[model samples]
Target: MASRLAAALLAVPSAAAAELPAADLLIVGGEVHDGTGAAGRTADIAVRDDRIVYVGPDGERAVHAARILDASGLLVMPGFIDPHTHADGDLLSSDPDRRENPAYLHQGVTTVVIGNDGGGSPDIAEKAAGLENAGVGTNVGLMVGFGPVREEVLGETNRAPTADELARMQRRVARAICQGALGFSTGLHYAPQTFAETGEIVALTREAGKRGAIYDSHLRDESSYSTGLKASVAEAIAIGREAGAPVHIAHIKALGPDVWGSSGEIIDMVDEARARGQRVTADQYPWRASGTRISNALVPRWALDGGMPGLRARFDDPEAAARLRTEMAENLRRRGGAETLLITRGIGDADRWDGKTLAEVAAAMGSKPIEAAIAILRRSDARVASFNMDRSDIEAFAVQPWVMTGSDGSTGHPRKYATYPKAYRDLVTSGKLDLPTFVRRSSGLVADTLGLTNRGYLEADAFADIVIIDAERFVPRAGYANPEELSEGVVHLIVNGSLAIENGRPTGVHSGRVLLRQPSRGTCP
Candidate 1:
């Protein structure tokens, strides 16, 4: 094995080396999905210069290659694309290898969309160039963040922007898109961003539309009432309608028990938008609980107007405290109470409460779960997890023809490790989504939706981004209670015609590049 690896290394050029033959790599004896939602077939894929050269059974017999991989008993499909992620940390951090994304590769994710929930790098151009120079484990892309952009310009106030201010923000969005941001992403439920009116969103989103970019949003609400799921869907549709942009609701969900059956309505809205010729789509992760910050549990938008400091002062003030408690009662009811919330991460001692539910921690503190939630946020710095979402709602969205799968999360989250696998195991192998259609949503649909060419397909001219998994044994092992664990059954992952993962282990090769949306190609509508 060592000698073979050495020989392979000698054959491949260093990152700085000049050009080489395109069909230098070969993968044989694998069942290919073709990334077009087609049935699997036995075929050998040939690659050269990072692009697929040949994709057929008979043509590979006479083909000679520098490296050959035996993929017998494995399903070779397009690498999974995480449509939503918080990997900005991975993108900008000092480390250049991007080892932290192994959890994604374990589940066969070859590409990820960072800059989610309105938080990410301030300079998309610099970040993109840096990641390309540093090298990474998987393909990465940027979505200009509304939160950081707002914070950069407006600070922590929740008021309507002046016409001049709005115009400046619009220019920033346009500049970022031209600098290679896939689209504009917003977390309107969070502070600063949430404070902006709907018109503000529409105006800025139009900038992305002019560049033919998509508007992916976390929505203004996911809770039960008063800016809840229905209103959230309405906002996304209206943004698309008003701005003439393709809209994608990030991590689309109907949260809370009161809105348990509202998934159908959300679907209907997306369908209606598409039917009316307004481009709209959504992504979902296969999980029963959504993750967020603990501070988000009880703090009102007004109280959080100044970011962390303002919220802390309000928590510390007795007069403000009293009013916050009254609001807290409503928040508890809206969130189905603190028992449904969990502390995911925080300061030094926070990791101890990582998997414990809100009820458990609250009981330990001898206080109501809501109070415990506030206490933890205050002490640990405001990170918490909400045990929201229904299995039926997850399945309903997962099986939709227009809905594609997304992790909608990041490291140490169950979705990060098990989302793709669980979706395939539950929705596909369990007879919910037919094999072809399932693979299509997981691979092709996303590629087409994101305007990613030479990927999401096993075709003659596509990038050799493929995954070989044991379909029967492929299932997500990570859960809400046990997040951060690796999944089972993904045997190999190929990135850009190179092996990034082998036999379910990362090969430490960071060959993935930034995939920017190229509207000039006329691929994305």
Candidate 2:
């Protein structure tokens, strides 16, 4: 079959090469899912100078020139645009010689939005320049984080931003957007950010929102931790209203036992919001377990109030330490206890503790699970895969059209290398969702959400970010035990007319660019 397809592609008996405009590459006779939420058609895709010049039936306008690739019997679709990721840190920290992002390309991702969770750099232009100058494996976009902006203005003080300080934060957010941040993101559940009042976040959102930037957030709380998951969703929605920007909830989930069936409620709220003309959407990983640091899940946000100094001071005082322990115990309960947390990435010296459950580690140390967790936090924090979600909730959210796919992570969880494929294999292929809908949510919806002009679709003149997949073989090979393994079955990947993956092998081409938000497209400086 491979040979036949190759023969068919090589024999390009159409318009003469000299008669047609030049093309960098041509993919012929494939099932073309145009990333438009419509059924695919058999067509040929042609790339030239970083853009798709043609997409139609086999002997189309863009076909005569360039190399021919036979994608016959495979799915040729838009290379995925992941809305949330932490890969910027990865690429920046990668060995200079090996800057290619294997984890994403292996999973068929061609673009990733970094600096997510309110932790993306404030100096987006600087990061963009660095990535472009150093060369990157995939097209990367930035989102200025609320966390950094707040830290810059408030210095981790547990208080509301003064009016003057608030003014400075607004300027920072506006500056990031002008320099090309796709949106403003918030890790409201995390520190310094958690110290912010709802009104303060609304003020920051307006700065980005008025620039047509998206308001994306890892909600203040997903479980019953702070205001309960429902209230957190409502708070996000309210912020959207005050800011006049679309609201996007990050890694939307009904986390923990208390929030088990809350997917229904969350879906309804978003549905009703849209019905009322509010633009609200959310991204979710395919896996049930969520990835985060050990301190984040078990420690109460209140105890970590004044940053490291406050935390150290509390730990030093015996009474405060006892109170901290009690609060930490309650926080652990909300996540269904320590057994639900699996340490995936360990800190220095404690590296041997990876791959063990918190409960198991506690048993080995002859200490209570909470005590062991506290000790581990004191020594060093490790990333964990918290298995506190219900399978029903994951699927329930998966089927919702407003719920798009995002890894919400990097390295520590299987989702980093498996989110899209898992969704495709389990949802689309298994008939829970039709193919068009899957493509729409995964690529088109996300692109539309971010207002990316020529990406996430296979139309003529769009960026040549495409992927050819063997649906049957495009499976997530990485498991919790061996979390670093790359995914499989991406036969070809093209990013901005450069072949990053060709015929099932990585070519290490850093053909990616930092996408700038066009001011003409309703964005402000």
Candidate 3:
């Protein structure tokens, strides 16, 4: 091995060779996709410590290396960066395996952004510290969520915040940004964020914007749930315009039968915003079904006023119960009837509902779908995969340049484990998206959108976060019914210059870093 490495280094120019220290690892002979949406080129990459030292033509000047990997006939690219995810639940869990995040590593994801949908701790510093101390398999970025900030200042009540409360919320957002939060996120579709008016969102978002943070939103309506899909897109754009922040729509989709063909209109809206010099982008998961709690799918915003306890109380009141059922029935219809809602996770007795459709449960109980839904919710907040999306809509969004790949990974959903590979198979293998575009959207596009430096790219001086895949073997194994299966064909994955996956298996290394955002000048004390 030493003699071969020496012979390879013979071609190096004397001056340049002297400056190039022995690389920790050298990967040679692969089709390199640099995450720029450009065509792949055959090249070699050398890593030392946590940064790439070289990326150029194969075997031209292969400096000395302690370890050399032959990546011939493989796809080498920047490790995927999941722009939106719920993986923090696992990263912060006490379970060691969960912290390792093999499911994601298997999918070739080296970094994940959390605190999405307005649901992360406002204390970015504390959260970052906790994650680093606990150890993680993938680099994690923190986003200060609007949901928690609002919930902290104003309980779960469905009412407008007063001037004082709004100010307090603004302070929290600013503080989080200064403490290194990448940006501010909101899941306006979920309460108590649902109760907030557009102006209120703009007010709080301005805090993040002033600190150079973007606004990532889970639009208030993906279907005809409330503000209507197109209107909701406009509202998000308007919020960003008013707040002076770039707008990013999380898990962008045209959900439900009502908005099945709405992707084209939504794209036009985003295009118009971009044409006017507004920064607008989005992330998408390949799956047709969206995952969420059963109550979130059926319960009306007004009915969720005080949360579960309040909803339970109203379930017993005759008048309120009648009204609640009426709205829930309509919601059920909007979601394509009970048959389309497949329960993926539940609590206690409701656990049996897993892998069963709402319609199936309702049939077994000899109860109406609404009653069955309520009964299940009363027992536990069961999560369901609502298969309401149209394939054409998903494909339409996939082809958009601004729409990058994201998992929105949550438990009981195959996206958590198979999103990246599934995207490769569905989009690239199917010829809908070329390999370069797929890699670009999965990695560089996300990094640029999130303002992450030296990430989502494979270049000298860039972070050594990389993946090697056997293209023919890369495919997703997980499904809605079996959601925990890890993907196959990640031959090697490097996180922070350390091997996290080798030869299609985890190396049990916890080399991930908590990537913190640097506050803009004068933004921090």
Q: Arrange candidates by TM-score, descending.
A: 3, 2, 1
- Among these predicted structures, which one has the highest TM-score? 3
lDDT of 2 at 302: 76
Q: Which stretches of candidate 1 lie over 4 Å from their true place?
A: 1-22, 519-525
Q: For model 1, how does the per-residue alpha-carbon lDDT over 78-122 read when each residue is reduced to its tens digit?
A: 888888987767656677555347778888888999998887555
Separately for all candidates shown, the number of backbone clashes (residues 3 or more apart, or on different chains) is 7, 1, 0
**What TM-score, computed on C-alpha atoms, does each candidate reach?**
0.92, 0.96, 0.97
RMSD of each candidate relative to the true structure: 5.1, 2.2, 1.8
Model 3, which residues run further than 4 Å from truth?
1-20, 58-62
> How far in Å is the alpha carbon of 249 misplaced in model 3?
0.2
Evaluate model 2: give its TM-score.
0.96
Residue-level lDDT tens digits of model 3 in 375-465: 9877789999999999999999999999999999999999999999899989999999999999999999999988899999999899999
The local lDDT score (0 to 100) that residue 452 gets in candidate 3 is 93
Candidate number with the higher TM-score (2 or 3):
3
